[model samples]
Target: MLFGKKKEKVHFNPGNRDDGVDENFVEETVNKIDEDDVEVVLKNEENIDKKFSGNNSLSKYMELGRIMVSMLKDVKNGRYKNIPWFTIATVVMALLYVLNPMDIVPDFIPGVGYIDDVAVLTMGVGWIESDLHRYLDWRLENDLGI
Candidate 1:
């Protein structure tokens, strides 16, 4: 302490609510998703789009979900293979989370219900942004429009 400044305690605050959808939860859920789950998400694409259509901000995240679905489909069909498995799983998890009505904040709730869904999608995008960009680049190179 003689030549250095006094140490100050630092408190960490995540600023997150009590919603059960944290990083660890997302990771666990992502790990559990398989090809079948991705298919389920694909089948329910209409519902997912409808659910997020009314709001502009939510619509953006919805589009991200759609892009993820396309990437997943391409990967499954062997059309695209540049993405990592973790990225694929994260996308599936985000889509599944949006499709579920009984998530941390039930979709049926008014106003703030989709907040957690958006958060999950945002987190997923953050985790796989580079991979996503590479996929997009591949799509452009192949003339497969997004």
Candidate 2:
């Protein structure tokens, strides 16, 4: 019973929860994203930056967001075709998830609202981390300045 209590506590912790955003939901949303969605993210770049720059757990992933945005822009302009469609979609999904206020955890909640966002962003970054590094290298080689 003591061990069960410990397990329950850990399960409830946002940082350790396994019931975060669903992969199917992410895939469905990502599939629907188009040029307009990309435009929305680009237009709200400053807002996104502000969200990530805030003093929270999500702040650490700010660089990841920046890399994703840069990759999205390049892909949009056809300057980066080396990335797979799934990677592009995953990045878009993550960015859009941040922009959405009514996600798995509503952003209005104090102290814990961004937990799910961070989880989603983390998952997306994990899925595309290698591609992101490759993109950065490409940028450097081409003088694109990552």
Per-residue CA lDDT of model 1 for 1-146, tens digit only, reads: 20122222222222444444455655566556666787888798888788789898687877887788888778877788666556767777788888888999998889999998888888668777888999999999999998
Put down candidate 2 lDDT per residue, 12-99, tens digits, no spaces.
1123446555656655666665656767888887777887787755667787788888887887677887876667667777888898
Find the candidate with the highest TM-score and give its number.
1
TM-score of each: 0.79, 0.76
Global CA lDDT of candidate 2, please?
Answer: 0.73
* Pairs of colliding residues, candidate 1: none
Worst 10 contiguous positions by lDDT, candidate 1: 1-10
Kindly give the number of clashing pairs for every candidate.
0, 0
Clashing pairs in 2: none
